[model samples]
Target: MLDYKVRTYEEAIEVIKEIGFLPLTQLVPNYPSLDSITSKEHWHTGSELDPWLWRAIFPGDGVAAYGKFVKKKSVLISSELLPLTRSTLGSPRSVNERYQDGLMSREAVELYTLISENEGIDTRVLRVQAGMKDKDMKKPFDNGLLELQGFMDIVVSGTKAKTNEAGEKNGWSSTSFETMDYWAEKNKIGKATIKVDKAKMKLKDHFTSFCSPETMKAIYKIFKF
Candidate 1:
């Protein structure tokens, strides 16, 4: 259990660095969550200290990486552990190669290609660009996004506000996507030569510091490693 509660954006960043990663919400058994650690009063207040706001800001600020890495659930990962996690969870084959091998869906490959080519694109715009704008395409588009994230191929880099032709902002902001390679380069996280087995071991040991045995088992089950 965390001895101190996280009450500020800076504190939350420090926690992620110290713990290696923190789920956006409670996920794995006994895992700490941003919601659980933070003071309740500041949530959804649109304040700088709000954890919800941090989710939309951390990646853009290079403070931490935001993605669906933990059991395919959203989490904030420290820069130090980001590459290791990628190496452990990601496929050794290229996206195209995986698609050719029938390991990935065509929709996922299309999304990956677009995300890698662009600096960063919001999902709302990305859907239209990928011809998934219709309501029926929502599930496939969403699934493809998650598939890329599961492979550590892309990440949530920032959030963008919706705008009208008149240049006025509309509705809530949408999460922006970018290739993991782009995010790593921007953050100065070098791709290392760690083997998959070693990388998994390292991450498991890091989590062992704070997780109970039951939690560790749950992680292994969820991650399938």
Candidate 2:
């Protein structure tokens, strides 16, 4: 029960952040009949979950079968609010890193609040399902998703305001941007030019040449900024 109950992808991330999503997403699928199951996986980077990927399957949870995951050690659990691990696994990384590897949604936030305020269970086993529509947070001053969207727009726009010795300013990760840009050009019908205008950047102007609103939101959320 460690994943947000989400219908659309955005609705899901709007609650749990990210830390609490990935593992739970995959685990639930494993046993469509299993309820309230707790599972863990090897956090490859010892950081947050890769912000770009949100699969309904967590193949890594079967690390025991592959002899890749340790058991009964303190492990970190990730969700929307922050990355934290209180696992019994004695994990090599900190709670923050574990949380990063997991993803959560905003609904998960309300779920946790509702549970803590009522359930009387001091556990963090979140489950994604159909429930009452939780109230929304006020318009975020740009959530992490928008923030990175803007930042990536700047980076992918292929323009830099300032430059390091190599001429770079405010340049975010190029690797992810390149992949996104390539796919965009290949798929987009208009195939407009993707350009970054640093001085004119605004979260409101989500017109990056490559990303759609949903994909932009998803990839940005993955970074957890």
Candidate 3:
């Protein structure tokens, strides 16, 4: 459990770094979350203390990597732990190799290519660019995005507000996606090829300090670590 209720975004960042992993909401029983530790009153208030704001701003800043990582839910992982986490959860094969091997759908590969070619591409423009703007293509577009995020191939780097033709903000902000390799490179994270077995073992060992046996079980089951 958190030592105290988190009241600020800075504290939240420290918690993420200390825990190494945190979902936006509690997906596993007794698992820590920004939601569980923060006050609801402060949420969605467009303030510096808001946890919702932190999700978009904290990533790609040399502190954490954010994406739909755990159970394909929004999650934050410390930059220090990202390499191990990626090695454990992400496929060793390249996107092209996975597609050629029949492990990835064509739509997913296309989306990945678009994101790879243009870093920090938001889903709004991505859909139109990839010709997935039609309602019928929604599922495929969503699935492809989720697939890339689940494998740590892409991460939420930031957000962009929707602007009207008059140059005024309109709707809620659109999230910006970045290729993980590009993020790591820009962050100066060294490339490491850790064996999955070793990576999993290390991750579990790190979690033992804060996670209960049942929580660990749930983590392993959900993340398939």
Candidate 4:
């Protein structure tokens, strides 16, 4: 017996691809069909679903995954997709169940997490963004995460300041760079190619390139993986 937690089926698929087993992972080891998870009550059969990608899909399913899997004193919780569950069954049973049945790679899940966190895009909306029609497009890719991860260094480091009614610095920054201008001025960063406020900012050809390493670090830190 075993238990697992995954937010959605797509996430499960993402994890599998991250680990370089997109096709096999999606097949549901032992060949469980899409309907199998939709119908079966127990997903963690203790035979399959033993990958880190599967562990992250629902890393918090302590009760549902752990309770059933950990029958004896020595229970190995690795090779899991999501977090360990202890009490709750899961969120949105119908939706997540379908997702849980699906398999993905941990790297894929992490990349997805980074993109959504960075863009502030909601996970639900991502389903549409990915347009995960076939297993191929839906399968994880290293390029997406690698490019994004590199940007993380600059996205995290940050500085902050505050202002008063007169529009003067009432005090030192109490928060990360008060605004994009503050980021530009302090870091000596040039205008970016894709600034939300100025269409002209795009003139830089590559907005991210213009950003200083510190600025990029700040951006990365905002979104935790």
181, model 3: CA deviation in Å? 0.4
Off by over 4 Å in 3: 223-225
| lDDT assessment of candidate 4 | 0.29
Better of 2 and 3 by lDDT: 3
Global lDDT of each candidate: 0.84, 0.26, 0.86, 0.29
How far in Å is the alpha carbon of 121 misplaced in model 4? 1.3
Clashes of each: 0, 52, 0, 55
Ranking by lDDT: 3, 1, 4, 2
Error of 1 at 199 (Å): 0.9
Worst 10 residues of 2 by lDDT: 61-70
Per-residue alpha-carbon lDDT of candidate 4 for residues 1-225, written as tens digits (9 for 90 to 100) = 012233455545543323311221222232222223232443444324433223322213221111112111111121121111111111222222333665334443444454434442333334345554345644444333332222221111122335679888675432110121222334444333332323223212222444355543532332120
Question: Which portions of model 2 show Cα errors greater than 4 Å?
Answer: 1-9, 14-21, 28-76, 79-84, 91-225
User: What would the TM-scores of all predictions be?
Assistant: 0.94, 0.18, 0.96, 0.17
Instruction: For model 4, state the Cα shift of residue 82 in Å.
Output: 28
Candidate 3 structure quality by residue, lDDT tens digits, 1-225 = 545478987888888888888889987778788899999998999988888998888885668889998777998888889988999888889998989988888998999999999899987999999999999999999999998998889989899999999999999999888899999899987654898889888988888778888888887875467
Better of 1 and 3 by TM-score: 3
Q: How many clashing pairs does model 1 include?
A: 0
lDDT of each residue in 11-51, candidate 2, tens digit only: 43443333332332233222111112222342222233422
